[model samples]
Target: MRRSRLGRFGSRLQSRSWPRFVPRFVPRFLRCLWPDTLFGRLVMILAIGMFAGQVLTSTIWFDTHESRTLEVPARLFASRLADTARLIALAPDDAARRALAQQLGDPKYQIAWIAAKAPGVDATSTAGFRREPIVQRVIGDLIRGVLARRLGAPPEIRLLEANVHDDSGKRGGILNLFDSPMPTGDFHVQLKLHGTGWSGWLDVRANEGQADALTEPHSLALDYLVRIYLIRFTAVCVLAFIAVRFAVQPLRQLAKAAEALGRNIHRPPLPVTGPSEVRSAAQSFNAMQQQLADSIAQRTRFLTAVSHDLRSPLTRLRLRAEMLPDPVWRERLRGDLDEMEAMVTSTLDAVQGIEITETRHEIDLDSMLEGLAQDLREAGHAVSIAGRAGRPVPGYPRNLKRCLQNLLDNAVRYGERADVQITDTGRSVRIVISDRGPGIADAALRERVFEPYVRLASKEGTGLGLTISRSIAAAHGGTLTLENRAERGLDAVLSLPRED
Candidate 1:
């Protein structure tokens, strides 16, 4: 029943980033112990609650446990006294009474006859006492009280005047000191016994674990308490971890699907399963992903249709340019026609980048860059590769090559030179392409340049290059960002995760 409630509770909690009830200004040490992950935090909260409950239960019941521990042995000792008195009463004389005392004595106790002493008790010691004198007093009282009831009369039951030999209890002993009736010291008891024409003292020293708490010290009590708590604490942690992890699994899957959605707009829809809340979330997510896919598909089709329709006219224009009478006129007309055609081609390419059809594979990035540099050199463009690309990146090989080509070509066109640097780490591979040109001083314009068809007045080409490059990078689960170099250039930093 509790598990069902926890599952429902976690369903609501899983959707939130942080619980509002949790205070923001937790102590630094406590914050350090707190986990960063959602799953860990949930488990930690559950474990703490369970551990506190166990501690509380131990405290509430301990008084009862302590009383029971002290009473059982105490009653048995009183019973032994009652039995001894009855046997002494049946004895014929003092000689038989003395013999009975020595007959049933154990190694831990000394039972012998002495002259009958006073009726009152003396549980006092001036010094050299570890256990409480009060605990010895309780032992004296319990024994005298129980023994009297069995004998049908109260007798002289006095304790010896000596150093009260005992030690303090282990756990919570001091807390309950004066108020508790439990004995934690031994009994060197001197009591009265009568036989036929014989009267004397039954002097016995009973070393009980409860009376002295000597044989069963407080340290042992502490050990038991600690051991039980540790075992339960461990179990609580383990159980909490398992339960929260299972309950929050669907949430994690939903998050992963959302993250992957941005990378692959056309990827398969999420499975609509699990708890009702999670299933609803998945359905909403899949619907949103479908809407985005349809939007991109419709846009691609529009661009493709426009490009296709313009191709026939572009072909006719090229044919007409071929018939120009003057060479200068023909060349200029041909260049104008070529620029128009390039605009159409770039627009189509930009749309196609969003709908990448190329299969993913591991491409040797260094070799791919070498190929790009070799091609650019043949085309009379100045380009240099300064560092290695380091690792095989999993991506669309053709789309990634095209993306790099556009960035490098822009660098060559504006800056007159391109310099590429590569760096690799466990998480990502970064490629920084630098150019020695006058960088865009306006930060807003630098970002604005990535918008389709937006270009600086002086630039001699369509502004779709960066847009297409960024789209390809996004599709490959990477990023392409521009930074104006400090001294005199612009750097295109392309960072890609090692995995897709």
Candidate 2:
């Protein structure tokens, strides 16, 4: 039971047809993957190259600017602190000496100096120090160096010392005092002045101030770089797009011309424009179109001539056969002549059909199918119609009707019963014509069964029926297919593209 139901379902599926108006998205995908189109490849290349160039330029600019702006200033401040410490250690008198010690103890000094006359003189003592303001000024200068632009107020200061002894073993109270409590900022340098045996602890704040000076210049340079890059990139993109479009314009024309030629052999030549290469391609396409048109015209003329010439001979043959003495032989001869005449007419019709351009308009498919069924029924064929009524399909109504008539006629002749079904396949509309007859041979399934003068053995109809059907399908940008039903029949499917 399951097998039987499955067979029936398969039969129904085999009978289904497709629609004509399905979007060609798959072709676009193919173009992207293996970009045969000139415009596509050019745009892709331009985008990638621009991206790479921008990245390289930005990396080089950043590396060069970082070292110049940030690293050089810190080093210069450290060297200056060492030189300043040496200068202060060589001061001449005790008054000057005391002043230097006060300078060292001032909180504002970025580089501080300290001195001791004897071993026991307290490092923190302010005794006998009358020039405090001078000491404060010197300390302020050091603080300015330490903080640079960052200093909000002066910092606190501290002083420390170690005692020394002479050769007699009696110690000098305070031998030397060192500057301490370094002002902490971004950079700190400690310098120990040698000789004079008075180790001067120089705490130098090395905010060399170069970064503040360079900031505006570097920013301006970066801004200019960005603006230049943007302008260049925009210009390149626009130019590239235009150049690419111009380069590919001829190809686009060639493609359209080729398609038109295929659609209508007598299509006009493509316009010549753009560069020499583009003009050449356009010229070639035009030539090709002309050649194709000539070929088709020649073939059409030949078929017409042959068809006209054969008619007279066929008429004479019929006249001669009618004069035969035996009635049965005469009748048989007449029948044969009639069949020949029918075949000739069909052949001419099929040939002419190829030249017939599709006239697209919205056609009510359900009504068309119903009318076909009615006509077939009136002609005494057992035809059944089923399925939901669908929206109109955009196609040539006359050609579509003729194609359907052929399929229905064949179905009636072979199966002795015809069933027509319509379905909306979302992207397309499918028409399934099922005939309860012996199915087609599997060996010929993939063959071009719709070619002119080709017919299945089971189908007792004009050989051009399927060919005409397929031509009509192709004209409407659809397809016609024949398949064997899993049950006991053959199926003819006509698929028409939907607009939506």
Question: What's each prediction's TM-score?
Answer: 0.64, 0.56
lDDT of 2 by residue, 228-284 (tens): 676777777788889889777767777766654554555556778778888888888
Candidate 2 positional error at 331, Å: 4.0
Looking at model 1, residue 7 earns an lDDT score of 98
**Residue pairs whose backbone atoms clash in candidate 1:** 131-166, 170-218, 184-211, 185-211, 185-212
lDDT of candidate 1 over 276-381, digit per residue (tens)? 9988999999899889888888888898999999999999999999998999999999999999999999778777865666566898899988899889899998
C-alpha RMSD in Å of predicted model 2 compared with the true structure: 17.0
Worst 10 residues of 2 by lDDT: 174-183
Which stretches of candidate 1 lie above 4 Å from their native place?
A: 1-37, 60-64, 81-218, 268-284, 309-344, 485-488
lDDT of each: 0.75, 0.62
In model 1, what lDDT does residue 295 have?
88
The TM-score obtained by model 2 is 0.56
Question: lDDT at 69 for candidate 2?
Answer: 33
Model 1 root mean square deviation, Cα atoms = 10.3
